[model samples]
Every structure is written in C-alpha cells, then in structure tokens.
Target: MSSATVDTPEGGFEFIVHDDHHHDDGEHHHETGTMLGFWIYLMSDCLIFGILFAIYAVVGQNYAAGPAPVDLFELDKIAWATAWLLLSSITYGFSVIKMHENNKNMMMFWLLVTGIFGAAFLYLSVEEFMHLWHIGAGPGASAFLSAFWFLVGTHGVHVACGALWLVVLLVQVQIHGLTHENKRRILCLSLFWHFLDLIWIGVFSFVYLTGVLL
Candidate 1:
C-alpha cells in the first residue's frame, strides 16, 4: 500500500497510513471494551451492597434485647476509621497522578502510603469488631448484630482484598516498569479503590450515622 506524505504547519512531514489508523482504532475499541466490562462488574457489586443495605435497613432495629447501635457504636473510633479510608483514597489518587507522569518511584511511594492507610482502617475495623464481640455484641447475638456484621464485614473483606491487590500491583510495577498492561491494571485498581471509598461513605452515613441518630 502506498502511504501519503503530508506537510505539517510546524514544518514536519507526516506519513499517513490506512493500516496504522485501523490498528489504532482497534486498540481504542479494545480499551473501551475492557473499561465497559469493568463497569458492569462494578454495577453487579453495587447491587450486592444495595441488597445488603436493604436487609440491614429492615433488621437493623431488631435488637432482640441486645445492645443497639447507640449502645455499642463509638462515633470517635468510626470517624477515625473513616478518615483513614478517605485519606487512602486520596493517596491512591496521587499514585495515579504519579503513574501518569511516569515517575515510578513516586507512584510506588504513594501506593505504599495508600496501603498504610488501608491497613490502619482495617485494623480499626477489626478492633471495633473485637470490642463488640467482647461486650456481648457478636454477630450471633441478635438480628441487628448479624446484619451489622454481614454488611460491615463484607466491606472489610473487600478492603482486605484491595490491599492485597495493591501489593501485587506494587510488585508488578517493580517488575514491569509501568508498561501499558501495568498502567491498565493500575487504572482498574484506581477505579476499585475509589468505588470502595464511595461505598464506605454510604456505609458510614446510612449505617453508622443514621443508626446513632435513630
């Protein structure tokens, strides 16, 4: 195939090739498809959390002679946990910015910061659960406790998985040096981390704040 040579305004000659344009379009389509698939997966996850929230809304008030939110929840601790998770989300954003700039060291450093914040959040969550359990507020204690544990525990499990994924991605960044594949993975992780942050906001507001108010 013959290629057309064109002169640019900047005095640079460009070669226009039909085959290369087609290849570029194909890659664009592939990236779009991948992101769309991930979005569908996120929507499914939202449905699961939505159902859990609905269930909790129904049974959250049923104490069955056990401790309720007012009796068990500490706003100070929950607020601190919220701060950690929120800060982790910010740090993850910084990592993405560093990734875009192709600064591997800075990206990795920000990711490490994010991971620390995530770990702190998880530790605080586990401490809350342990405190509740010790004070006779175990999951099996009542319908309310069961719902609380199921909903919050599920979110905690997601955070744990995200933290693990971050570690693997950090290794990949070290080994692969932020290739296109690695960048795509990083974008996906960014989406997942942000999604978790949004979910936690919902949990904090709807479950904790509302529970305390009622």
Candidate 2:
C-alpha cells in the first residue's frame, strides 16, 4: 500500500495528520483565559475599593468644622438610589436570559431598561452631591466629605461606564445579532452589572446605613 509523503527540511517523510478536535480545544482554552483575566481584573478593583474603604474608616469622622453624615446624608435619597441600582441588576439579569434564549428583541428591551435604571442611579447620586455642594458640604470642606465623595463618586463613575457599555452592546446586537462573540460580551457585562450591584449593597450597608447610625 502506498501512503502520502511530504518533504521535510532534510528529506521526505510520511505525512502525519491530526483531527480538528484540537482547534475546538484551543478555542475553549481561549474563552476560559478571557474569563479568568476578567476575574483577575475584578479582584484588583476590589483591592482598590478596599483601600478606599479603609481610608474612609480612618477619617470618616473628621468633620473639620463641617457637617457630619447625620446632617448631610439623606436616607430616603440613598434608598431611592439603591433601589434603582438594584433594579438595574435585575433587568440586566433578564437581558442575559433573553440573550441565552436567542431573543434579540427582548434582550435589547431589557438592556434598555437596565440602562435607564442605571441612569436613574447616577442622576440621584449627582443630585445628592449637588445638594451637598449647595449646602457647603463639598469634598474640600472636610476629610469625611472628601472620603464620602471619593467613594460614592467612584461607584457612580463605574455605573456610568457600565451604562455606556450597555448602549454600545445594544447597538452591536442590533447590527450583528447575538453571535457567539456577542453572547460572550453580554455574559461578561452581566457579571460586571451584578458585581456593581453587590458592591452597591455593601455601600448601602456599610456607608449609608452605618453612617446614619453613627
């Protein structure tokens, strides 16, 4: 029996072929690497937040002749902002479900709803900051206010970024439908949105609620 042969650098040799299964394995590895990298990034972010929280804990009571949390923090407003953010997480979850179902329209609608809720959260947060500024409670006024603004403002910025990301993803979904790449993107966004919600819960409990009590 004759067999196929190929030329090597030095001589001819029998050709050896492998199945295409390794290609699928390589792709799976790539996907896992992507998720792992994102997770590592999130952990670094947690460290940043942890340091901020530690700083706040150290100087959160230094009023420097300024208003304290009791005077400046509004529970009602915080509650509303929390509700909006939490609801946005829920809507994002729905969007992910719709994506899994391959229902592009429903996914887009849920993403829009999530964005609106995120916007509401950011608006409420900005309003609270503005009210503080108008009342002479700006970050420069005291260490406590500075820490408060830095921590809360950082979270607000993240939400704003997430909202923008959602908009871009929505446009991509419209243009490309829910391709495998898009689904992966949506899943990553879902992780990020839920992570924010978890962080906000911590903010509400540790910052807002605890501040009011203190």
Candidate 3:
C-alpha cells in the first residue's frame, strides 16, 4: 500500500491517506503555511503603496501653474465610484459566508454580483481618467498630475487585476464545484479583495478627499 500526505482543509495539520482508502494521523500545516506566505506578500504590497503615497505627498502640490486636483476632480463622480467599490466588498463578504455554508450556488451568485460592482467601479474610474485627459489635465501636465495619476492609476490597475481574477475564479468554481482547492483559492482571493478595499479607503481619504478639501 502507498500513502501520501495531504493537508486537511479546516485546520493546521496534515494527514496521511493511503491508496486503499485507509487514513492515518496527520495535520493541516500546508494551508497555514500558504496563508502566512500570502500575508508576507501583502506586506510587500503595503511597502509599495507606502512609497507611492510618500511620493505623492512630496509632489502633489507642484502643479506647474496647471490644473489642480480641485479643478480636475469631480467629487460626485468619485463618490459614486467609491460607493460601487464598497458595495462590491460587501458582496464579496456575502460570497465568503456562502462558501462557509457550503452553498455553492449562492456563493457563485454573490461572487458574480461582486464582479459587476467591481466592473462598475472600473468604468467610472476610466471615464474620469478619459475626461481628465480630454481636458488637458493629464499626468504629463505637471508634477502634481504625475503623482496623482501614478498613485491612483496603480490602484486602478490592481482593481482590474482583481476583477479579472474574480472572473477566472467564477469559471473555475462553475467547472469544478467547491472542491477543497477551489475553496482555498476563494479564501485567498477574499483576503485580496478586502485588502484592495482597505487600500482604496486610504486612497479616497488621502488622495481624493484631501485633494478636494485641502
């Protein structure tokens, strides 16, 4: 008889499963290790964002006698985009809850809803960027515009990546059902999605809101 080590889905231990349908003592350490590695990756991302924020703080006022944030930013439009992003995070939470319940259909439904909201956010953000470019308030216009676009545009790219990942995950779940690997992938993506939401909060506060107010 042959045996292989497999991590259990719910805990921090690994167990051995045999070819002949026999199981033995083990623990689920793999999942825990994976989560820790992901946390480290997220910390690295934090460092990147921190650098961008510092750069923006330094150069955000150097408008080169060009348009400032107040002249370019439409607060109402940004507010609506923010609403869509926040709502997407909430819907992703619902999907996670459904995953925990092992309700695949409801989970997929909520995940799809989340994707829609994310798409709406991206649409509004792109529209805002297009408007700015059309009005000659683009990144090359000034140091202020450069920093603004770099920071916000980087975040927008991340959101776009996440949205794409969501679509791939949806198709994976549909084809494979809620297997253990699928569930683990979902959990990872959940963390990623919520992390984006938190970062967006910082962007909204430090960049958009303050850009308008101060």
Candidate 4:
C-alpha cells in the first residue's frame, strides 16, 4: 500500500479522504492575523491624528487677519461637501457587502461610486479653500487660518490618499478575485474609508458648522 502526504505550506499534516472529498484548513488564522495587524496600524495612525487635533483645538481661534471661520465659511457649500463624504462612505459600505458575497462587478461598481463621491468632496473642499483664499483668509493670514488649514487640509489629504488606495484595491480585486488576502485588503480599506467619514462628521459639526453659525 502507498501513503499520500498533504502539504500545509509550512510542512505539516493535512487530512486526506479516500472519496472525492476536499478539505483544507481555511486561512482563517492568516485572515485574523492580517485584520489584527491592520487594526494596530490604524490605531497608530489615529494617535498621530489625535496629536494634530489637539494642537488644532488649542490654537484654533487665533485669527490674526480679522477673518474668522464664521466670516470665511459658507454653510450651504459646507453642507454639500458633507453630503459628498457621507455618500462616499455609504457607497463603500455597499462595496464591502458585495465583496463578502463575492460579487466582483457589484463590488467594483460601488467602489467606483465611492471614489467618485470622494473626489467630488475633495473638489468641493478645494473650491471652498479657494473661496476663502480669495477673500484674503489663506493659511498664512492667521493662526486661526493656519489651524483651519492644518486640520481641514489633513483630512483632505487623507481623502485623496484613500481614493488612491481604492484605485489600487480595485486593480488588486480585478487580478485576485475575492481571495483571502484581497478580502482582508478590502476589509482594511473599508475600515479606513468609514473612519474618514466619522472624522469628517466631526469636521462638519465642530469645525465648519460651529465656525459658520456660532
């Protein structure tokens, strides 16, 4: 009689069946490890933002050029900007659900929508900055302006980065299908996208709205 040995990649035992049965230990451990590593990386990123936010809070009101946030920001435009980011986050949620279902086209479509909305938000935000700059309230004008620039610019940079990442992930998904690694990448990107939305909500209420109305 001859014996058959199964490979586990790291050189280990695998279950073999006499019938036409297939069994492989799912890469659940690898998936879990990837998720944990992603979370740790995200938390470390969060700490860096936490410091920036604290600095903004401390020096956020120093408007040396006589142009306060209320004077420079327009609520209607800010509202539209907020809607854009919120929509992008919702679209990304759809993408993740579709990814879980292994519906590649649906996932890609939703991700495209997400990226479009994200880009729109960035466009609107840049327009808003331009509007402010035209009114003589650019970054160098005041500490208040500087803080605003620092905070809002930080978030915009993040959005741009996220959009770029979505492009990369879209390509990866196209190449790999809904693989374990690809799925983990999607999961991490989803988290990053939603986290940006959460922070933008803070930016809207505390930064834009308060600066405008209060």
Off by over 4 Å in 1: 1-30
- Better-scoring candidate (lDDT), 1 or 2: 1
lDDT of 2 by residue, 1-214 (tens): 2223322322112211221222346323335544677788878888878888888899998989878888888899899998998899888899988887889999999999999999999899989989989989988999998998998888888888888999999998898788656776788788888888888887898889999888
Ranking by TM-score: 3, 1, 2, 4
Q: Poorest 10 consecutive residues of model 4 by lDDT?
A: 11-20
C-alpha lDDT values of all predictions: 0.86, 0.81, 0.85, 0.78
| CA RMSD, predictions in order | 8.2, 8.7, 4.9, 6.4
Question: Which has the better lDDT: candidate 2, or candidate 3?
Answer: 3
Candidate 4 structure quality by residue, lDDT tens digits, 121-213: 989988888888887888888887888888889989998999999999889878767765577678888888888888888788778777766
Q: What's the TM-score of every candidate structure?
A: 0.86, 0.86, 0.87, 0.83
Candidate 1 local lDDT, 139-204, one digit each (tens): 999998999999999999999999999999999889868765577678888999999999999999
Which has the greatest lDDT? 1
Q: Which is better, 1 or 3, measured by TM-score?
A: 3
Candidate with the greatest TM-score versus the true structure:
3
- Cα lDDT of candidate 3 equals 0.85
